[model samples]
Target: MKSHYKFLGTFLGLLVFNSFTLASFSAWIDPYNVINSRTLPKFNQLKPQSNDDARRFKAINVTRIKPKTIVLGTSRADIGIDPEHPVLSAHAPAYNLSIPAGDMYEAMRYFQHALVNQPDLKQVVLGIDLVAFEHREDVGKLDPEQAARLETTSYVQHLPSLVFSTDTLTSSFSTLTANLKGEPVREYYLSNGRLIRFNPPEMPIEAVFGLHLKSAYFESWYKDFQLSQQQMDAFRTIVETCEQQGIDLKVFISPAHVTQWEALRTSGLWSTFEDWKREVVNITPVWDFSGYNSITTEPLTEEMHNYLESSHYVKEVGDLVLNRVFRHELRTVPNDFGTRITTANVDAHLAKIRADRSKWVRRNADVVQLVEQWSRE
Candidate 1:
């Protein structure tokens, strides 16, 4: 009787253990369906390999990013600045860390993460836009599970166990296979020719015009050009934190389609933006490209084509913006000085800038013009 009771107890113990093990595994595996099984409509009918492969590869690459300056913004800024370009070499080693559809909130979170984990980080370039402050459905929706997996703690604590996991390896293989079958690749491609693919989505003029009018014009014009005190407080918090951390912060507005800008100006959003700009970073060079339409006498239609379609020139545009900031000698120690751009490094950077004058001017003509104009002032 005693022996039989012990056997029964052991059997039940094994059953409970197995159940708990399976349940824990299920939690991990279920989320993988979101990435691997194409459960979402946009991803549906895509092979399991597509989602898993890209993310796994991204995770590996992200582990390698030890940047001195991180460029944060939406897809427009991401595509505009190439980190590997020679122009950026004069600055600290830059990482084009912008994510697609990224906004100010997301940018703030990214900066927070970088500050906590990357001690070597020295500077940040935040591309600000009216659209960044506009309320959006997808703004704060970060995946908790993905966030956990990507956190600095995961890299330090469980990397070995994670690397050895059979499930992880299986998922990675599934992802690679989907990628090989031409599941839409993201930033980089390896097997095909080492060509950088430029696939900008077609932007409808009506949609652009409507967004401009709604966010830039209607919100600022009719609703009031006022940000709630809470929002202003948050912005101040970010600025203060950067100052405390000794990070060099550069804030600038990105260019938009001329028609969009005209609508925004007429709608009175431009005035609000200018007002907000004066308050945000008074001393820093604010490169407002919104006035490009007035500066260039080119036909509005032709200018729109040049602005919208010119990916190659977008790099030049980025250079132009940064150059304006540099030439104005807007370089100053933050009042709440935590980190200073090293003097030796700045002198070395200035030397490089002098050596690369033609390259800098061509790459950043918009910036160069502003600097020349400012020098005269």
Candidate 2:
């Protein structure tokens, strides 16, 4: 009887040990979605953080909550365009899937994932960044492991989130800490999936231009850039996929502020810019909005209300682009707002751009000085 009691005691001890082991693993691995199980009061609302890395957190969830229309691009599209805007929502339920500094490869990856998870997606509003097309090696080049992780099917890809992954746990903890302190959580996406500006500066046009002068980021925009074959292949795939799936695709270049144009001109990249427009026209017609135009020249009057900086434009310009593209509220496309580029007329269009750019360069001495400084550097 003592031997029997000893065996029973050992068995009970083992059972208790097993249970504890499993519980500890579960808390660490979090496979049952316990981390986000309880809603934090402050983080209930979708707040898009400005960091590009924050995109990974949103990418998987976007597939599950797929909207009919997806807006894809870099930061310009992230903060500039609102999918929930009335004009976009009127056409279809829309979501902005743009990422900060997102490239063509990332866009394709995200959209492809969305298509796989939600095949009913009907429209793709792609904001084609001109810089994305420069150089073959730079386009779509991700480490093999990272690429594999990014391309995993949505069903399995997001499973890690159900558990206590570092990214998810950190974000949750951060939100909790912020909530406890009554501080704003630095979030990156709205519930509607549009990027929110945490705090936009209210400055005159001169201050805005001065900000650009301090950063030489625009220099690369003008130097030794060329459209890549790989980029073209990726772009063609997106176009072909949209066509095959009966998805309405609207592609446009983002509206760069005039100072950006001046930089390009001063650096002798204007001709290259025209060449890019011509090449893009061959692949598919695009509404070119980058150069000398009323909207772009708005800074001259200190009344260019739609721009935040040389590279960033406000949502109002996005609205104008949408209106021009869809004709939702306007009978005619707004003048100098956007011009559709076609292969048939691209040469003529490019010539006119040259003339306009030269005329502007001659008149704007201050902008010329800024451009010359950038060029010299």
- TM for candidate 1 is 0.52
Candidate 1, residue 264: lDDT: 46
Cα lDDT listed for each candidate: 0.47, 0.67
Q: State the lDDT of candidate 2 residue by residue for 1-377, as single tens digits.
A: 99999999999999888756644443343222222233335533322222435365446555556578889888888878888766667446687878676667778877887677568888788998766666755566676754654565554555544333455445445544454566543434555566655333456666556556445355444456666777777788888899899989999999978887776666567777777787778889988888787788664445557776677788878888888877666654457678788988888877787788778768777777865765565
Cα lDDT of model 1 by residue, 70-117, tens digit: 777665566555565444555455666665554566666666666655
- Native-to-model Cα distance after best TM-score fit, residue 78 in candidate 2, in Å: 1.5
Can you tell me which runs of candidate 2 are displaced by over 4 Å? 1-52, 90-92, 136-138, 144-146, 155-159, 177-187, 198-223, 300-304, 331-333
The TM-scores of all predictions, comma-separated, are 0.52, 0.79
- Looking at candidate 1, what is the lDDT of residue 315? 53
Clash counts for all predictions = 6, 9
Error of 2 at 212 (Å): 4.5
